[model samples]
Target: MSMDLFSIARSGILAAQSQLGVTSNNIANVNTEGYHRQVAIQGTSTSMRLGNNFYGTGTYVQEVKRIYNDYAARELRIGQTGLSAAEASYTKLSELDQLFSQIGKAVPASLNDFFSGLNSLADLPSDLGIRGSVLNSASQLAQNLNQMQSHLSGQVQQTNDQIESITTRINEISKEMAQINLELMKTPGNDAQLLDKQDALIQELSQYAEVNVIPLENGARSIMLGSSFMLVSGEVAMTMGVTTGDPFPNEPELTYSLGGSELKADPAKLGGQLGALFDFRDNTLMPASHELGQLALGIADAFNEMQSQGFDLNGELGQPIFTDINDPVIAAGRVGAYSGNPGTASLSVNIDDVGALSGSSYELNYTSAGTYELKDMKTGAVTNLTLNGNTLEGANGFSINIDAGAMAAGDRFEIRPTANAAANIGVVMSDPKGIAAAAPKITAGTGNSGSTSVKLVSIDDRSAANFPVTDSELTFTLDTSVNPPTYEVFDVNGASLATGTAAGTPPQISAFGFTFEVDGSSGGSESFTFDLSFAPGDNTNAVAMAKLSDSKIMNNGKSTLGDVFEKTKLDIGSQTKSAQVRAGSAEAIYNQAYARVQSESGVNLDEEAANLMQFQQAYQASARIMTTANTLFDTLFSSVR
Candidate 1:
């Protein structure tokens, strides 16, 4: 009986020792990250039967189990991913917003200053200083646009660098995960520390891209991005790579592979920092850059065309005020073929309607044999086109002419008409004397015997006007036989053109490039003559240039230049604000998930301390039983002797 008591006391002592060790371990690692609380479970030992009665044999310790909730872990990962994406998006968008909010030398401000300079020139049409101011303002505006485009390009490059860096980190993590999977398969479900490390690694990976973890047999896990872009499966890890050889100011394409087979996954499927960066680069930054280029191109082309129609102070046809894109298509106005494009077709594009242009890039690809597809990168709208002998007419507000080459199957092209206009624009006319501020001259002839006076109005159509090779004279002969004196028009050769009863109205002249207004009536049998001559001091062209500030010349003439810029600013502001709000919400959700994990698996020092005391007392009692059993056994032996 005493022997049986010794066996019972021994089991109690061992069970207490194990429980105490577990309690101590919990207290020690209370501050350790990713460490779940552990508990030592004890069960009753096998019974000993004597005389048909079963009795317990102290206790046996089961496995030390770590407290973990897989659902909470998943929620925590998702929340953290959301927070990371939102924060990344907010950071980039805020930078863009601040960039557009330039204090004085911003694009909009420079544009306004340019118009103001034009208005000043209109007030003093012949002043050289004012003309110089106008020229300087134009130059400054072009400089401002150039600076903006350069900055945006820099940002794009920076974002791409970050993307490559992030991808590298993700690859490293995935490789580690594969290594861990191999290690775990050797001793499945025994390495609690290894499991903890794997969870931590997964959390880190989620910051760069969406992660989905699937537990397989043998306690191994597979890491996937988006839906099926597996990073790791069993002991294999897929590698990620970035493709290069594209032009500057554009991001390289992303590539994925498993072992050695190349894989393609849509970037949109990603959801963390990687996804946010891709979205900012493609959706926000690219479009905004293209829109700015569009504005610059539109302004330059419009002003240059107007200046061409007028005469400078030197009485010569004005030169181009701004150098525009050479062919109004492709990035930097240069044709682009896909890096691996299977085509030799060279493309040229013309802007049929500037106002109809949208701030978007396009993708041109061959759908099949002798067929092409045009897609708007921003909207994903597709337009089908037949080959039509290498000309695509009236598509997307532009005409595409393909020449001197043939296309192979699966060829692709990228067209960014307005993406680099700002960078390419320049002040072509350096001389202030080249600024056109005068119109064709008109004058009234010296010989007239009537109360009627004539003044020259605008020459609406300069191309159709038949200006005489030499000075031409227009004579108005009147007849007082009618109540309202009738008049007959005669050219320089006295050839009668038209005869009509005169009234108080302006009459358009077919011979000259102008119209005339007669305020007073002609006397009986009187004659009036007028001639057209050059006018160097005219401000009509300058005034017309100044009016472009308020003209609806963008968005199919539905928006002004200022309106497009304002919309851009507002869009950036709205995106920044939305990202901030989403970040806040995601942070809150992450905190809550963390709290849930903590409540379920976190160690409690006070509770561990209490457990320590209980186990200590139990240990002491079991030791006392051993002592008592030993003493009783010694007494029995002495009595028997």
Candidate 2:
């Protein structure tokens, strides 16, 4: 019937109009970011029966469906997060690498110059001009170390500032996300624009930290940061903040709070820009600072020890050429107490042997009364050390002394023996006469009838209980009446200090921190005596100090001063190279993921144009149906009239 025809034509027209509208919308928003292509779905309407024969009722639009793939979006987010982290790490590490590569050369050059000055002084021990030059070189080396330490400390502070700024932005984003969730819940139908805005915010948030999105039945979403902390839930958001860390005031820690309750976020799980900054500060920057400090400590302490065992131009015992290793301020800074400690315990660290230092930090935790455990921060090795009275001795190259109060069982302290050495090191001796260029003891033959000579090898320990005091003499007499030989040693007061058989390859005698070689091969009675007399022209101590440039006195006697600096440089270079490689790989992955997402959900102008033409043609065809049905209705009316 004409009536049925009119109804069918009307339905067809409505369906075509809907399709045309959808196509036009897609074309209009072709360049809009975060807009997904939409499609109008068509379905057949209910049929009509007349005389046992069914007839179609044309078509109607079912729904306008958004084109999106959740899986693809998730993969894109993951790729974005990885790329952000890699790039952040590479940027920071490259700066450090470049710093060490450029300014780092000054340290090695200064070290060489200092040793060269020492050699020049050794060639002419009594030259005041040479001594002054040596002192000048020494001062230059200290200044270089101080400058390097200042730069490294500045990097640490900059990193902390970045962390704080990022945290504030994250908190702002969290609040905005909460607002979006509330809007989604209040909205009745699916708001395509609102959903697009939500997704855009999520993508932005992923740059700072890892994010996990969860969909709710009420059309709202929940966002989790680092896959653990809930950043947004329904209408509420958690706040993130940074605070000064315990034990180390320069370090910063991340904190989370919600509804007045504080929560802790696992630092390792924060794998994005935030995580990269934290890693750089803790692993790369801090370790490099410590290594440089260790090198400074080794140099300063070695020279100071040599000075202590020699005499100056005025025949006085030499003082420290650099600041004292155990100065009160320096010692107290080596230990950091945890802020949560209930006891009033205070501790100080003293560098007992510079050569034995490992360039690592340690954690001291009290387990019981007068009992503690020391853990190496680098290697994670733990050692049990018991407090003997007020001191704990033999800790790597250092000793811990209780300065005041007692510690509770759960108290903890961070011990960093060499962390501040570079910053605190200085050239304390200004006078050229203070340089120790002569040996403390002078040896000679006491009316010997044999071809024998005495040469002082080294002063092993000046603090030995039986060591001779200053201005004292030691006498050595050899008796060949025995098969091999026998020796007797006596102090200045005619008291026998030691007696032993002088039987060796070259026949040497050791006593009271002094090793002397007595060659009695020309078979005759030999006698020698050594007196504590200052020889200003002697270059014995200067020669020994020059040898330190090549001496393996660091890293438990495995690395020299130069070796330590080179090793530190190599470590930073290696890390920078690794970060660059990782960043390249991440970029490749991110590009692939972005392409996939664009293909799946992104709008295409060409495709949308084609769809628009198809829908337009369909609209024209449906309009023709309406025209035909109207004409047929007019013809039926005329026939009836």
- Whole-model lDDT per candidate: 0.78, 0.85
| TM-score, one value per model | 0.83, 0.85
Clashing pairs in 1: 441-533
Per-residue lDDT tens digits of candidate 2, residues 1-641? 77777788888888888988888888788788888778889999999998989999888999888877899888888998999999999999999898888987889899999999999989998899999999999999999999999989999999999989989999888898888888888987777787888888888788888989989855578889897788888788888988778789889898888678876676679888999999999888998998999999999999998887777787666778998989988999999999988789899998988888877899998988767899998899998886777888758888999999988889999999998789999999999998998875655455666465655545556555566555467777777556456778878788888888865656666677766565545466666666555577988889999999999999998999999999999999999999999999999999999889899788788887888788778878878888888999899889999
Residues 375-424 of candidate 1: C-alpha lDDT, one tens digit per residue: 88778999886555567764665666785587777878777767678887
Compute the lDDT for candidate 2. Answer: 0.85
TM-score of 2: 0.85
Clashing pairs in 2: none
- Could you give the C-alpha RMSD of every candidate to the true structure, in order shown? 9.0, 7.4
* CA displacement after TM-score superposition, residue 496 of candidate 1 (Å): 10
